[model samples]
Target: MKFIYLDNASTSHPKAPGVATAIANFIEQGSYNPDRGQYSGANDTALAILDLRRRLARRFGASSPRQVIFTQNVTMSINLLLKGLFTAGDHIITTSMEHNSVMRPLNEIRAQGIRFQVVGAEKDGSILPDKIEASIDANTKAIVVTAASNVCGTVMPLREIGKIARARDLYYIIDSAQLAGVLPLKLSELEADAICFTGHKSLLGPQGTGGLILSDRLHHCRPLISGGTGSFSHSEELPGALPDRFEAGTQNLPGLIGLAAAEKWLTKQETKILKHELNLATRFISAISEIDQVRLIGRDADYCQVDNPGRIAVISLDFPDRDNADIAAALYDKYRIMTRCGLHCAPRAHKTLGTYPQGTVRFSFGWSNTVSEVEYTVSAIKDLSQR
Candidate 1:
């Protein structure tokens, strides 16, 4: 059977051409350790990485590329914030819509005497910025949340929440795991202390290249690991700086190179990419809305002001008459359509939507997903319901 892929939220399918080309070029023709040598090849490599930083800074509206520290993925970056920024006494506020990437670290910190509060979003997966603001107290130190939920694809009220955090003098960290490439942002306007996102999703970059964009406010965030930082070679301590301070050991050279190329491609295609994804998402939900017995989660009436607007092109359809996992399994095994079911590593989010034990079938779209794919997915859903 011909396969249809609709799980971009988990990890994008068939990355952009430059993604693999750059990585392969690094392994084949561009092999040199950046910052380790003064020779031409090493220097060229250094220039490449520096260029990546510059582009990413502008991509996220960061002050400089040095503020962009490369990590394996959003998970590591989020953990870096939880472990290093929050101390035993610091109180942190998060939302029920967070992925395990953010929750696990905070949960561990909670055991170690840190205070962590999870503000709940509305039943439709919408989080009012004020809800997070109201949870803040004298002891609240930082607020960490996802830009848009991974499970339900509901965009949060970041503008209002960011203002609240700024007014209250609290650190605001946004996990843009699902929204990075699909969304546009003025990070400077958000006034975030640190913004964590991965390259694979939305950003249209390869895996193992996502990380954090930290503001100058988090100069005090301790390092989770320390190793050769290229800078300050003579000293045993980590480099007392932004990227170097957070980045330890040799960086992911090829991944960074691919990421740089991906950024260049995305910068030019940002608007087109969003419109394509939005249109596909719109077509998808419209098809699903026409299907009887299909309940779409995170339903919204509007579609503007968000990169992934209308709440969901990443639709979660609950087949109450049938087992969700069985439907998902059949969609893949028989229909050749890939989807995600169960908690999707966000049990807390699933709980918020009341889909925990029997999670809904997730069909997340991407910029490259054609409308025909949406129709195909809808057909499969209709078939499953009929069965």
Candidate 2:
């Protein structure tokens, strides 16, 4: 039986048109590493990588292509930034709605005297810029936050927070995993020093493809790993350039190539994709709100009905009298509707939502999901609720 995929917050499915073809073509014909060799194949690979960088730079409104630093995924990019940039006596500010990608690294770096204060989010998962500003102290070095909550889909007030960061002269880094392709983002407008993004999610690229867009201000941040960067190989020390300084080791050529294709596809379909996802989410929320036992989490259903919605299509539901895991399992087993259940690697977000330890079942919609699929999932939920 075919399954309805509603767990796109974890990873996107049916990737962009031509994504598979791009990866397959690269693997089959030209699998050379970029910037490593002088042959024609190597030169071609390097140019393709450069093209991807330029595309991403223009897509995100970065200063230049040199600021686009590729990494394995957003988690790696966040780790590199958190571990490499801050030192002893430096404090950072973040929201309680962050994924483990930010929380875990911050916890690990506490051993090195780097500290962070978490500004609490409202029960609806909304954060206030004033609260963030009030939390900043003399030792505060940066403000790191996710653009939206992966658990509840509540969009943060980034531009407001960015203004606060700018006024305070603090480095602002954003985890754009949940917001990248779903929302139109410009790093300059957000006043962000860096944006960590993952390709396998909203970008609709292959799994191992993700990177960071750094502003000129953060070009001096220390590298997390040092090795051969395919440039300045004669010297034992790592290269001191923009990307080569941060990106070390053999890159994921096929994945990046696939990402380039996905980027091209997104450039054309972004408006339609956003419209569809919003419609599906609004429809699902409207239907589910009618069930008495079923509780819709995050911002009110009305928030999604606007012309420009604040949040993505990630919907989490709480079954007050039913086990969330059991409901998720029943969804897949009986209705062939796949979903994610539990903390979703974001215990802090769950805690903020008052669902910690008993996390909600999340149904995240994506570009390929249809209105019919959402309606069917809602019907299944209604039937399960009655049982």
Candidate 3:
């Protein structure tokens, strides 16, 4: 039986063309530790990293390539930013729809006397900038929020929130795990101090590839990790530079190469890919809406009609009486449809949506998914709902 993968929110399947080829080439050609040695291979690898940084910087609207700091994933990037930037007496403003990547780190640092307030989201998973502004206090230092909801693909009002942050002189940090590669982001226009991203999700890159694109304001923050960055070895202190200050230890050369390849492929077809995925999501939502037993979570009455530009192709389906995990398993065992069930690492989002304990079955579309596949999945769900 043919298997259908609908778990793009967790990690993108069928990565961008040439991603595997790029990784294979790097390994076959004998990859070297970038910025580690004086050898030609090391120099070339270092240049490749620089080129990737430059391209990513330009794409993300950074003033310089040095502003991009590589990390294992967005979690690490967020931790580095949050832990390094804030301390006792600091206040952080965020939203209920944030993933654990943001929430967990902030929670961990709360012991240091750094306080954070969560701005409640709408029933439809939308976060209002006004609500966020209302929560701001005299001690507010930064506003950290997700670009979009990982569970429902609800696009946050980034521009409005950014404006509030800028007007208040608060650092604006965006977790773009679900937004990067799938949506166009101009950090300069958003007035964002930093945007964290994971390449394994919408970026169509391999696992272990992610980073942070920050403005010059990051210079004020200290290094989260201090070790060999292949630069400023003579000094005991970490290099007070853009990337070197943040990136420590050996880099993931193959993963970075794959990420660069995926990024290149994504840039070439971003518009088309986004349109295709959104269209599929709309079609799926429309079809699913027709089923009497099926209820869509975190969607408004006008969701189907809204021209959701920043929204990705993620959808959550909640069965009032049925077990979500059972439904997901049935879809897999009976229809060969692969989907993610349960809280999806965002218990706060689930709690906001009132689907905390039971959770929901999520079908997240991607660039590789087709309209026919979406229609088929909808049909399968319709069949299961009737039973």
- Clashing residue pairs in candidate 1, if any? 181-202, 181-203
lDDT of 3: 0.89
TM-score of each: 0.96, 0.98, 0.97
lDDT of 3 by residue, 177-199 (tens): 99988767888888899989998
Q: lDDT for every model?
A: 0.82, 0.92, 0.89
Check candidate 2 and list the clashing pairs. none
- Candidate 1 matches the true fold with a TM-score of 0.96
Candidate 2 regions with alpha-carbon error over 4 angstroms: 305-307
Relative to the true structure, candidate 3 reaches a TM of 0.97
Model 3 residue runs over 4 Å out of place are 300-310
Question: What is the per-residue lDDT of model 1 for residues 141-201, given as tens digits with 9 covering 90 to 100?
Answer: 9999888888877888777888999999999999988878776665787888877889887
List the lowest-lDDT window of 10 residues for candidate 2.
Answer: 300-309
* lDDT of model number 2: 0.92
Candidate 2, residues 196-255, lDDT tens digits: the string is 999999999999989999998888788888898889989998788888998888998899
- Give the CA lDDT, 0 to 100, for residue 118 in model 1: 93
